[model samples]
Target: MKAVLGPFVPSYTGPWLAGVDEVGRGPLAGDVVAAAVILAPDRPIEGLNDSKQLTEKRRELLFEEIQGSAAAWCIARASVAEIDRLNILQASLLAMTRAVQGLARAPEHVLVDGNRLPQWEYSAEAVVKGDSRHPAISAASILAKVARDREMVAFDEQYPGYGFAGHKGYPTKTHLAALEKLGVTPIHRTSYAPVRERIEQIELF
Candidate 1:
């Protein structure tokens, strides 16, 4: 995929281009995590792919490798409450902007995964599957996924019944059953359809 995308072909023609991606967008709980990673143009990491395609162990290994290889990297999050307040799209963009702003070195160009680029000062291009095609984007995806997963795991320890560690806040059957049994927790996203429906049903009864 990298070869097909021509990562070496220099899409932005900038020396310092940062790629950004976010994770936990579809989850019913937890913050949306965004990461921005700038790679040294000359030292590209091999075997980079969309983080979703990789196993947890592989993603963790790549996350560590990216930390070492990137010229600059940062992760940021928009809380679940913020997501409810601003809406997910806006919250996600805010998280991306925060991640980029946190970077030590300012990026000359930004390559964002998915179609919409945040309203930011930097010039950017949005590629639909940038994470698989761009090294920096792939790095960012890994960082965001790993960070969010870790956060969900910690939430599992705190919440005790939701299986957050197992499903990472995704709306799985186990998660839904837990929600039905336990009612909503502070961590649950009330704005999400499943959660809202559950709440309404419980309220009626």
Candidate 2:
């Protein structure tokens, strides 16, 4: 038999391959959301890039395009309660796993946009900064970010002074100050240091 060599190819470029990415991991409130997308080889979407690199308006536009063009796509989340119980990292992985499993059909391979892969049965690879490099991952990133941002905007109406609309549940100075002055809301992650400190202070009184 003759030895043969072939050029390496990224699995995400293959059929039935999914790219996964998450958003809202650093936020002090709201769930960590993840999205999985299996892009159609024939239907190439233009301007796919890291969701953070794009404006909100651009992401919104791409979000629709991805949904309409992808062969399979799903968005899933780990709640604040899950984050507190399992820790943020584990919860994020869980969210990603859920997103992959939620696809209309199982992916032959999964490319995750981070250094770690979730513990799951699917064949997967972890690609650092994959969102910028892979179209599927970028699509996933846009979906996760837009979904989570919209949720936080809705939370702003319910929580009022916390500025969830502006900060999107991140631990901004305004958010920290609101936590101290207005007290921790139910959406706030109690496992986080700032929220835990507030809870302790309330317990002492």
The TM-score values for the models, in the order shown, are 0.93, 0.94
Candidate 1 clashing pairs, residues 3+ apart or interchain: none
Please give the distance, in angstroms, between residue 187's alpha carbon in candidate 2 and its true position after superposition: 0.7
Which sections of candidate 1 miss by over 4 Å?
1-10
Number of backbone clashes in candidate 2? 0
Task: State the lDDT of candidate 2 residue by residue for 1-205, as single tens digits.
Answer: 9644232247545689899999988989999999999999999999999999999999999999999999999999999999999999999999999999999999999999879989999998988788887888899999999999999999999999999999999999999999999998889999999999999999999
Model 1 lDDT, residue 102, Cα: 99
lDDT of 1 by residue, 27-126 (tens): 9999999999999777778778899999999999988988898899999999999998998999999999999999999998999999998998998889
Backbone clash tally (model 1): 0
Model 1: weakest 10-residue lDDT segment is: 1-10
Candidate 1 overall lDDT versus native: 0.90
Number of backbone-clashing residue pairs for each candidate, in the order shown? 0, 0
Best by lDDT: 2
